[model samples]
Target: MNLPTASRQDGTYPRPQQLRAHWADLTGVWSFRHDDADAGLADGWAHGLPDARDIVVPFPPESSASGIDEPGFHPVVWYARTITRDDLAVAGLGTGRPRVILHFGAVDYGAQVWIDGAFVGRHEGGHTPFSFDVTRHVTGGAAHTLVVRAEDDPFDATQPRGKQDWHETPHEIWYRRTTGIWQTVWLEAVPETHIARLRWTQAGPAAVTATLHLDGHVPAGGSARVSLRFDEVSLDTVEVEIAPPARRVDVTVPIARLRNGQAARELLWSPEHPRLIDATVSLRAHDGAVLDAVSSYLGLRTVAVDRGAFLLNGHPYDVRGVLNQGYWPQSHLAAPSYDTHRREVQLIKDLGFTAARIHQKIEDPRFLYWADRLGLLVWAEAPGAYEFSPTAVQRLMREWMDAVERDVSHPSIVTWVPANESWGVQHIADEPAEQAYARALADVTRALDPSRPVISNDGWEHQNSDILSVHDYEGDGAILARTYADEAARRRLLDRMGPAGRRLLVGGAPDHGQPIMLTEFGGITYQPDTERDDSWGYTEAADGDDWIKRITALYDAIRASSFLAGSCYTQFTDTLQETNGLLTAARVPKMPIEDIRAAVTGRRKQR
Candidate 1:
């Protein structure tokens, strides 16, 4: 049967693992209405919002890609769509009493989902995926009304807003706010007992440890089996007896055995050679009848910080990274298409950068998938809250946990940054409570994924961090070199500058033994076209030659530091008023692409 897929621009789902599965994409035109007074529930709009106009799904109303092209702040927005059983059947789902799950890639702030006017579930946190089982509310060969209500308060300092502008207009570094559904919505069919979550971790370079979490009870005398394969070649098969009330099962596979006496390095995953292993997990009854099956993939790699160096697969790996805000000119926070993400990753690789600090945004899963497939290291960072109140801390911690859980499976993500430059926890250097909070976040991240490094706060005042990072946009390369000439001089300058200077290094003053990186620098402003008064960068350059000269000098300063392991340029593309990007907002190169690549790869000397 020809499966019915979403007519989305990219014609794909955000999660690649779900592509061949029994699922239907619901990301097209939908009835939309703005609720300024939060009166949708009071007025019984969940039954149907017939008067609402049409707006595309998976794109915010503020984004031009949504077809609304309205960039106003709407605290509440309502969306309504009608789906029939045929719609599910066409997508190869909703058959044979299967459990139908409604999934939302993401909805801004808080979301309430209802099917046929019956409230199914509600979810908080704007950037994480959530789902609800709607089988009871949905009937085969019948029409069902699906309504979604999203409430977002841009000005709420208690919420993690990230770079979304809280004001009515874009200001400073923040851009337009994403209001309603900004990601894909879909439906999937699963068995009574299905695989709920899969966690993969590499044990050394030749062994992989996996944990499978089942969503439902296993039948009596049934067992769970998992098969590992690489390039369609079977490696190992393991089976576990069904245990009552135990929802989790652990299995370890030795990949070296599959190599047949070959070198173990062939199975390792890195930027230069990204190798992935596919797996099929199944739950079988006593008669050997397959009750459930799901397909997933994993990459064997390990990341750690060893003796002031970032180690990837137990080897010292220098991180050549760029700052990516995960924004598009048309879609704002939402990517215009899945291909857009793929192209961005390829472009970063072409630009001679091995890694990208996904700045202040939990990126789309598709982007992380491409990063894994194309081999680009990523530093997953959490959106920031401007305030340090208890509510803000609680909100950030909860949302960050969800974010980590959502992207933990992606092998390309080598580092987890809970905070950036102390944006929300501003008083961490002085306030003991804030310091404790930062440390707690780092601890939580390490506990969640012990294989990867966690940067408590990427930039300054790091209470607990696997890597010591700082953001120094010192325009003059000579001064920057002098500032970090030696460990003692760096500490003296940091202490004298104090916390107010934004240069103070808190939490033990960056011992030379820990991994250090200049996470943000070389924000040379270059606008080839007419420069508006609002457009600004860190330091302005006269032309392409001057820009190249300044950037190369900054790179030289970073390369000269014996303690510094890596550096990330200001950004990959121009975002809003910030023009300090290697590429223009339209993805156009400002200077010669090869020249920029040479500067970043350390192939060219400062001249």
Candidate 2:
């Protein structure tokens, strides 16, 4: 069944009353309809065009919950809404302040935003958030019109489009395209002289530092007071002198307050414990006046790859994780609510998996936030298509830089995987360029966030990487780990199949002490409805009981192998056309949850 749709201009997701305490999701009915090809919304013709047609906010027009469930034809989807300065005032915007910031959670492909009658800004990336300062556009208490025009070519090869196959009916590997704004749009007020941005890091138990960049001017005070709260309790409060351009503000909180060291034991956030601590930060003037306050949260957890074993909290830990694409049956690329997003993460955790490799797509910031709080480890990956251009790679690198800059603060993100299996690199005959791009991304990612490990390319050629990775789906579980019958048998197998067969035999879990991860494997598709077909992992109608046995045996072999560190199962949920998933498309549990948990956690079944 489809999710409920909201019908008000000022309503949030689900309803206005159940707003998430931490966020304000401006998702509801808005004025939207098809525009003429001659007169477009971008050319300021949308000023007073009285088209009160209904369109759901936050859901792409093509989605089932969008109220308009028709397929978008790659045409420009135009949206216009008449919002007053007072609208911003209710959201703590334009409240006697000369500066206001309007933030869009995400927009597909390219978008142009016009506030009132003037153009504000345009952004390119379809998966990341962007904002525009629209204070000057507001004229007194009068009404202002905001218009956004978005265009998306879902099959654009060079762009980082993941699993979005336009022009094709529902297929095996790809699903529907989500265009226009699929996330929230909200405005917040900030003082004329205020802290514009902050990049911070936690060095140790007691110390944390941030480099603040003020937008226009710092407040008229030499000292700025900073306060950090953890769930209503102040964790750290300190006063520091403001540097003109910028200065690093360092604060030391008690070990109990920071909870950095205690996390290893008492308060460590883990799937088993799932402890979360809130942090609300506020910048203040020397006179004890609060300047700006934004709610934030942090988890204290560390992941390391050492001695050919993955370690969490300084102990050898095996990661039974899944490769989650983060797509929904109805919402497609977007989750209907923060609760919906949180439910997915909780499902991963509930399945006895400690981590998840978010495959092929840069997820919404909320996913990372939920992972951090819910104690689910994440391996953030960049979307890789079958083609790549140098110019496109450069832009991708820039977006990756921004993604890292924005996501580095979260403890749940343990690794950065820049490419998946060298899909596009193969097209380039010059091996040097391909290797250079791979190495360059590794270098840039490491330079950007040295704390996390970076996997160069998931599988394919394996050019250069901090960790040796493979995507193996060899024979069934029994044959994959079994010793090759002989050199002739191995050669015959290699000759019959392609490079994939060769990699399975030759790679054999790298002998080097460096970490070895089965980044992709075990995509057993179990479609009970189609029982004639027996390939349970990748095909429908496979033997349900046999599927479980094979997967469990595969996990057993990998867990016993000394060379392998961890394995991420093919997927968590069955995405649209790809039915190889542990759970059904709607995220309903397929097999017994206890059985899957037993296989993953290595827990001995009770007698």
Candidate 3:
């Protein structure tokens, strides 16, 4: 489970796929001010905010890491940072590599940025990342001031504000609002025209297709060279001309393993034996000069549904997943640090879970990078919208596409969850418009990435999905075992409303041909040494012994099921008032880590 990253490379610059060795992290202290009145623009705050306080970059103001841990409703906020002349030199930006790209991993809700008081760009969508080129503003080796404004309306139900609570105070299920910047901000130097996007898809066992997207139209006689390697062994080096009007090119690098026969599966990536092939896609000129290049890696793996089972690399693979809301007590939605990301992934694996369904939030790429490198499977789910509407559909479509496009290159991602438990499309059981929206979530995601399965609605009442995922929290192990004893019994359970009071399928039901997976269950609460009425879970356990007994029974029942392809525990760790997790809010396990791992993997020691 402690497998090394594909490249063991430095994960800087926010964008993990298009990585460059030389870059500057703009994540230290920055000038910050709460523009509650929304008058920062008229007051020329962009020029400079004098009475501003120092707040840490990336971490939102609601998070303690930001140095302003006030969780109040601040609809408008601003941040200012100075990129010094030395910073650019250290990042290797200059003539030839004249372009300096300012990248923001993510900004909540809406954002507008300025450099030297010049409006550089504006972008919306809280969970998706965006960037801009500011070389003109940073000319002549001089320092430039970068200012940003972010607006997040807490009460806007149409917003795809995942777990961010609209209420003034966070309540059950929803967490605090993450206003302004909640991810990394950095600077990287690139050629005038660089490989803006890179994607690797294993269309067949023998060949891997690479698609490179250019930021700008390539010069007439430009060519792109793609080199592939596995375990330090070269596979192939293919070059294609970047002809005009075509900003995209797909180069198929024939993998040697396929031609070797029988050894073709050697490079297939799985949780146990995660093997990654290293690659470097370089932008070359007509004269064969390398204009720009990026280092990346991909796993030759495929995930799909094959006749009532989830297949990985064309074989049935059960996805033993755990729910991860991606929340840190100190950092909230923002990851505490990169090491924290690694630890979280490692901890989940230590519990014997192979995959994690990132509950609502779209996690940062660094986390996904580690998941890809460390061999933990991921189900990338979009944040839920409380209510459905025209605006909500539009917002989700745009942002979900952005989220999918950004993380599609990661081989660790095996599923795309666009909607979950009908949070947005609540009336999809009958409503045509809502059903259409749910169907579109699946269709559009497939159009973007057909390599993985799409769980349009994850929990129950699934509109369009590859697997029949249900959530049942029946604490009584005996009754739960009886409910899904076999295929017929499981079908009867789905014929009625699910534990969450939603139909198993809407606008017509599952034909029962897909694999069944219990996505959520066993939220057993156990608060050892501390007791509070406000804190609760779906079911309560008396003590550490009781928690272990109850969790073991739950896993035993799941393992006994005859129709389950896999199952996911309620959650990986506790968050705030939610006391139902294998680990506590601070990540302290309630029982022995080994015991939890035993129950999770059904690897109980002999009595």
Candidate 4:
């Protein structure tokens, strides 16, 4: 099997036509060493050439596959590589225009890019994509040195480092910290005045609007002719004038061009039947000259809360989900490959859950791509910090907006969670700062993507949001607490004072009343002595039958509660040492799969 290089070894980097393969994947053959470079570029001595040190692409330098079979490394790290146009052109650059742009899919926490000594730019967030215009820096078809300096301060609790335990090398809950570039690094060449960014939105009926954001110099006389297609069907073909260097033109594709029931149609996207339509976008001059082209895909689906029920495609659909950690045994934060991500999704679906709560960590876009294609609903959450400072909050929220814009096209995402269990709002004791932070984040998330629901805080504090979402490990404690609160004189006294309980429902009530989802509930860890045994044991090894009984009992308790629309187990697999998972560490079923499936799916023949 052939692998991708920084520049195509054959001198050709694939074109936008091969967008999926567009990235040169400079993951392998890159020289690696531990370096503590300051954020600001400083003059320093470095190796003249990239040594033959190989670190696997998308994996941290400390991993075994990165040619360094070790765990611990200093937070500051550096990566150096050289790219050649001749090598790229052979790979696929294909004698196109000499212009080229370099892209870094993602880097951890912070990174600075340097092209042969001149600093181009720097990015703060670790989980989103960033790019640089290196066309000017390239010495015309010659090889150029590209350097990336990355640092992740594990002790800096102010930043959004989710489940990343600095002190604990690899423990129950925390996984390895992915430093430097943990995503694909690639380069591409395009027309000088080409399309920079494009967005498509469906606006009911046969009206699908396309917006084209152009960059560089636009022809003063000609208009931008926009053309798009879904499979063999041509959805739109229109000509709109580009006002100037940074102006964007909006065009509506005709509904009739969509073809029969397929043309300009809004098809439902769900787990049972994952349907997707591939789209091709092109920019052309008024004289019919094609300037640029790119391909993308989208799913047609909407999620909302209506009349005390979660609705998908205007129908009430019960959301049975599990909390997905987005970590793997083989690669930790970095998945082994695309196939590994697919296998995890398949495991979720096979367990009979339709949705997953992607807790804390901002998952890779490829994972979201699979969710959109496989019909898995997602409640995407941003990594939260334990403490909230103004500058930190501002930076985290800005990064959140960038993440949303990059992933808004995906259909699997149904909600946004800005703060998780620790940020603010103590479940038992809600601090004023925590409450204030939750309220502020809720407002910001809505302003960014009002299309989806925002959970101000997933658990503990109920400062704000579209749904009454909670994470409780009380072990059927809500039931007993409710009973006691209803009977306690203190509750009666508080009720007599005014509508205090009303404030309990975060975000007030939805237009249709706030629906409650026990987003997290049972985390019954059952590890049998034999790997192939069918026993459910909690904590340590309890009676095998007792474990199953307790899980069923918890399900009944949740189902009987009117406040909770549904519940999600703590997790599907036993991740690392925190073996509180329904499934074993290897994703093997611990109990009879059908038994748990019946309880979760509400298919127990009704008493």
Query: Which one wins on TM-score?
Result: 3
lDDT of 3 by residue, 378-467 (tens): 999999888898889899999999999999988899999999888988788889889889989999999999888888788887777888
| Alpha-carbon RMSD to native, per candidate | 3.1, 6.0, 2.5, 6.0
Candidate 1 local lDDT, 1-607, one digit each (tens)? 1222211113256565433356787989999999988889999999989578899888899988888888887899999998877767754564432777788988989999888889999998888889888878885547899999999997898888789998888877889998879988988777778777777777654667778788787878878887787776788887777886779877777775635535666776799988877777777788888777766677777888998799997789999999999988788889887678889999999889999999988888888878888899999999998999889989999999988887888889999999998888877777788888888999998888888899988887777688878888889989788767777755665567632276545655354467878889888889998586888787899998999888888888877876778888998999988999999998988987889988888796447
Clashing pairs in 3: none
List, residue by residue over 1-607, the lDDT tens digit for candidate 2. 1112111112233212112122223567776755536357545554544555677887887788878776656456777776764576565554435577778877887888886667888998777778887777864557888878787766567767666775646566677888888878876566666555555465675555554556655555645554455435555666666665553344433335445554436545666665544433445666766665544445555666777667775677777779998888677787877677678888998888989998877787667766766678888988765576876686678777777877776677888988877766663324677767877888899998887677777764444466656677753655655522333533443334323642421222233455667778778777655332223345333476777776787787676564667789887988766778888878887787877787777785687
lDDT of 4 by residue, 1-607 (tens): 1222211122222221124234455556676656544422333413222333566767876665566555675677767787776645633453434566777777888987877777878999877788887778874647878777788887787677777666646655566766777766777666676667666566564555666777667776546554544444665566666655646777666556434555333445677767665555556666767666656555666678766578776677778889988765555567676566667777787777999988777887777766766678888888766556776677678778887777666678888888776552343233566566677787877876677778776653455677766565555435524522322522332233212132333333222355667787677666664442332323333655666666666666665555455467788777666666767766777777776677666566344
Count of residue pairs whose backbone atoms collide, per candidate: 0, 5, 0, 21
* Error of model 2, residue 573, in angstroms: 0.9
Candidate 2: segments with Cα more than 4 A from true spot: 1-24, 33-53, 94-98, 228-235, 247-264, 427-430, 483-512, 529-541
Taken over the whole model, the C-alpha lDDT of each candidate is 0.82, 0.66, 0.85, 0.64
**Sort by lDDT, top down from the best:** 3, 1, 2, 4
Please list the residue runs of candidate 4 whose C-alpha ends up more than 4 Å from where it truly belongs after superposition: 1-22, 36-53, 90-96, 139-142, 170-172, 221-231, 234-239, 254-266, 424-434, 476-512, 529-548, 591-596, 604-607
**Model 3 regions lying over 4 Å from their true place:** 1-6, 510-512
What's the TM for model 4?
Answer: 0.84
* TM-score for all models, in order of appearance: 0.94, 0.86, 0.97, 0.84
